[model samples]
Target: MTKPKLSTPAPVIEKVAIANRGEVAVRIVRACQELGLTSLLLHSEADRSSLAYRLADETLCIGPAEVGASYLNIEATIQGALSGGADALHPGFGFLSENADFAEACAQAGLVFVGPSPESLRLFGDKISAKDLVEKAGGPVIPGYQGQDQSLRTLLEKVEEIGYPVMVKAAAGGGGRGLKVIHRMDQAVEAIEAAQREGLSAFGSAQVFLEKYLAEAKHIEVQIFADHLGRVQHLFERECSIQRRHQKIIEEALSPSLSPTLREEITQVAVKIAEQAGYRGAGTIEFLLAPDNQFYFLEMNTRLQVEHPVTEMVLGVDLVKAQLLTAMGRSLNWQEAFHPRGHSIECRIYAEDPYRGGMPSTGVLGFCHWPQGPGRRFEVGFEKGDEITSYYDSMLAKVIVWDENRPRAIEKMKATLRDCVIFGLRTNIPFLLAMMEHPEFLSGQMTTGFVDKYFSRPLKEPSLTRSDRQLAEAVVKTLNREGLGGPRPRGPDGEAGPVPSPWGHSWRSGL
Candidate 1:
């Protein structure tokens, strides 16, 4: 299929309804403020206390705490937007960001969906269709079977043709869900069933396809933006090679591993595919770079990505603002030749136990504070007294840092993570800090398997040094006086730990 003829009329948007919640919604609200637009936050019962509510100009209750009833309910979302008198709706990253039906519904309702058209979403929303479009545009896609034959027999046959270790990927969704690797024929049927079920459950689609699994591959993606005027520009590439269970945990800009020639070729290919699909607004074209430097198109994300901040930090461009402009019918001011100014890294802060099998932990947050200063940005979604529920994603914030180059960026991230304090629960801070200092990570020699190679199992907490002890002592005293949740970290010697400032706790705190 070729790019569809673009003819959607652009409207003058004055208010944008943020159709999702959490950090991305918060970011979009700020972007709307900067662009002189009102932000209408569509939230659920679970997000009544979220900071997005305070930041947005107004709030509309969609449904209960469950995501399906609120965030993913298209009818409720459209009703809220229409009732709230919004001219446009921004779906952030997850939820209905890439739902093609939602995009079509918004257009029919006379509201601009701050994203690509329904056609673009349908073409690229499915992994199979996206691969076909990339191939039609002369982009390299990994050899695999994307035929309409989703039968168990045909899938097994395709696996046999592609050899063992083939990947079963959900054609209709992302976020690392509905993906399974079958190393042998014995695992094929089970993996396929599980992937299909998950695909249906998560994305409302049961279709799945197969792909060749590259054991040592780097997850790289290019940020592409296009206006309704047929202008396309790439903001450059981001290396999300550090991941766990196929979900990215850490991301960086200007990958240390990319050769200049290879980088240019892959990113241009990304733009090529975007034009082929008539892509607009903020979208990501993901590719997998093999060890030999041969990259293949993986899929296209038809909405804003979770790790877009790393690119913003390096390029000093607000992608959310740019997206707003494009949605408002403004042409892109993106230079044909854009140069990234600095190196940056983003560490996802999740409210989970990194030392205990990465289990999800939830409760009322205590004295939550983050580092502040130059080059340190903490994009968060919660406050001290807010409850952390299991209904949503575990990610609480992202600690992003920028510097002159990669080395300095790493060091800055280290300092920022050390200063962050989030009492009342265990977090992934220790795991992230250790991952940064890992020899492979420091040398920039990493792939998608970096986490599994070193963190196959839960890691034990590293012993705290003297400075760490002092920081912990200060945190304990502060929280104690505030009558917050969390106690002093106990030392290995049975004394109050003068140890690390936050993250691990002596016990899980309650509301």
Candidate 2:
């Protein structure tokens, strides 16, 4: 008798080009190292002295400091990858991550784009097309007008039918780029025009559609994966309800409000959207959950997300590794729902002044230290002496923590935020800590408006005690010396200012 055994094929890529910068780029580089794949970091001149530049196997300068000239320059990015001998490219969260033409270009150039095919990218990139497919897949899409009739007259008519307080969104925009919320008929046309202008400038598409904007809804998303073998799986859900200006500031797994039935239904809907589109690779299906528990599919991000670490911490799965495996034509190890091991939370640490209306802070980090513990995972973009530039997103790092339950996780996060030290720029740490202790948040009853309703600065100024006044006087002096007491912090345009290094302070009392 004779027997034969089949050997598994290896993953697809040997070398990967990270076509972005900052924390996400560093995330990709680390994943490549773990998988034994060579990493080529395509960076801008501003990021040349950054941390990811040294960690990757190779680094190539794509263009100057401006994002349009560097990270968003498709031709230069691809050229850098090819010149560096990279066989694949991983577009981290921003920049060209969701650019369909970039995906097509990579395919034509014989390079594997780690996310999805150009078709998938194009389908989901356009809001109109995405709505059509969600309906086809039997997923609930927000009621709106997503027709191809681009005439202003036609749009105005649709807006009238859709009623007031509708959201005008760019057909091919993301990250709140081409979005406008109009609450009256008179504001509809202007809103559409503004959104179209933003769309044209940001995504190179001026097309926009009107959708009914649900007020005070919760933002939730399902982490999903699809392989080359026609199999799809979900890794539970994350509640990203805490946000400001439509951008997520905090994320957590095992949404506290969802019942068992609602969870199953929502996750299935997310899977259906992916299956109907023949989607491959890692992606997220975002939805707006109403107070009554009715969820509507918002959009699908066809790549790894900024809050992916929270999912990883709770589920004990490496999404980047799974992305690599799926890109290599392998199926998920288990084509079913993954059980979460614990509760996890992520706080986006931005270089912004929350007190001064969240103004972006750009300079050198005077001092830097992240929390370290068993369940703490930091995805940092810079080093101790790194420059926190204004050329990109204001987020500088992420602090992800895990525990056996939600309350414990929140407590750990509060302590972690208090212990960390950062200097030379204002941050949102105090704001985040306040959120952790807020009654609504602690009770797991948060909506998208939670921040504005609860965290808005108190109207009346409380009397400061003798010690309080003394401390405030000291802080003002320190801030003035550090150059943070001036007007808005200017970005790196002509002459960049020196980064101030001073002793950092929490500067806030309990709510």
Candidate 3:
């Protein structure tokens, strides 16, 4: 299939209803403010105390705490947006961002969806269809089976044919929800079933596809933007190889693995694919770069990515604002020759226990502090006194840092992560810090298996010294005196009794 003709009329947008939550919602709200547009946050009941709820110009409770009844409920979101008098709706990644039905409903309701056309969504939403389109565009695709036969016998046969260490992915999944690597024949059934279950639960699709798993492949993606007139521009690439269970944790701009020639080749191919699909708004064409420098199309993310901040930081551009402008029928007018300035790195700060293998840490936040400094940017979603619930993603904030070079950027990110103080939750900051110091990571030669190969086991718990204990006691005393979340009397150890912190009895403050 060739690029579809562009004909959707751009309407004037005054109010943008954000059909999402967390830091991305906060991101959209701020962008709307800068563009002189009103932002309406469509949130669930559990998110009432969120920072995004507080930042948006208008707010509406779409449904209950469950995502199925709220964030993923098409009718509820549409009704909420319409009732809130929004001229447009922005699904800031995940949930309904790439849902074609949601985009069509927005158009029917006269609300401009700040994304590509519904046709484009449907085309790229399915992994099988997307791969076909990419192949039609003469792009390199990994050896995989995207055939319609989803039966167990067929999948098994295909897996045997493709050999072991194959990747099983959901046909309609993103963000690594239904992606599994089958290394052995005995693990095939369980992995495939798990992938299907996750796919059905997360994306309402159980169909899966198979791929040749490149063990040492580096995850590289090109950020592409298309105007209303079918003009597509490449904002360069992002290296997201440092991932856990296919979910990216640390992302950087201008991958350290790519040569100038390879970078140009990959980016141009990405542009070609986008133009072939007649893609509009913001989208990312992901690829897997092998050790031999050969790259293959992995997938396409048809929405603003979580790591967009690193791209924006290096390029000195605002993608959220660009999405809004595209929705308003305005041209990006990007420079033909754009030079990426400096290096930027982003670490996703999740509310989880890193020492305990990243177990989710949920509770009322006691206190939070992000050290202010130049070249450091934080996209936070919660504040002190806000509750971190189990109903949503564990991510609390994104810490991004920019510097003159990659080495400086890495050091700056390390310092920034260390300076962050989240008193309530046991975050993955320790894990991120360790990864930052890893020799493979420092050398920029790590691949998709970086986490599994080196950092798979739980971290060694650090012993608290007498001075650390003293500092903890002093901090707890201050919190008690200030009546922060009420006073916690005393425990057996008499160390201020947990203080609503996720660390339980231990009170190792800050990152």
The TM-score leader among the candidates is: 3
Give, for candidate 1, the lowest lDDT window spanning 10 residues: 1-10
Q: Could you tell me every candidate's TM-score relative to the true structure? A: 0.90, 0.87, 0.93
Q: What global local distance difference test value does model 1 have?
A: 0.88
Best by lDDT: 3
Q: What ranges in model 1 sit over 4 Å off?
A: 1-10, 462-511
Comparing 1 and 3 on TM-score, the stronger one: 3
Q: By the lDDT metric, which is better: model 2 or model 3? A: 3
Cα lDDT tens digits for candidate 2, 230-333: 57788889999998767789899989889999999999899889999998888999999998889998999988999999999988888987887777676667
Over the stretch 1-511, how does candidate 3's per-residue lDDT look in tens digits?
Answer: 2231233566778999999999999999999999999999999999998999999999999999999999999999999999999989999999999999888888887788999999999999998999999999999999989999999999999999999889999899999899999999999999999999999998999999999999899999999999777789999999999999999999999899898999999999999999999899899999999989999999899999999999999998899999999988988777776799999999999999999999999999977889979999999999998999999999999999999999999999998889899988899999999999999999999999999999999889897777776776677676555445334545436665554633233344443
The Cα local distance difference test for each model comes to: 0.88, 0.84, 0.92
Q: How many residue pairs clash (N, CA or C atoms closer than 3 angstroms) in each of the candidate models, in the order given?
A: 3, 1, 0
Model 3: CA > 4 A from native? 1-8, 473-511
Cα misplacement distance, residue 196 of candidate 1 (Å): 0.9
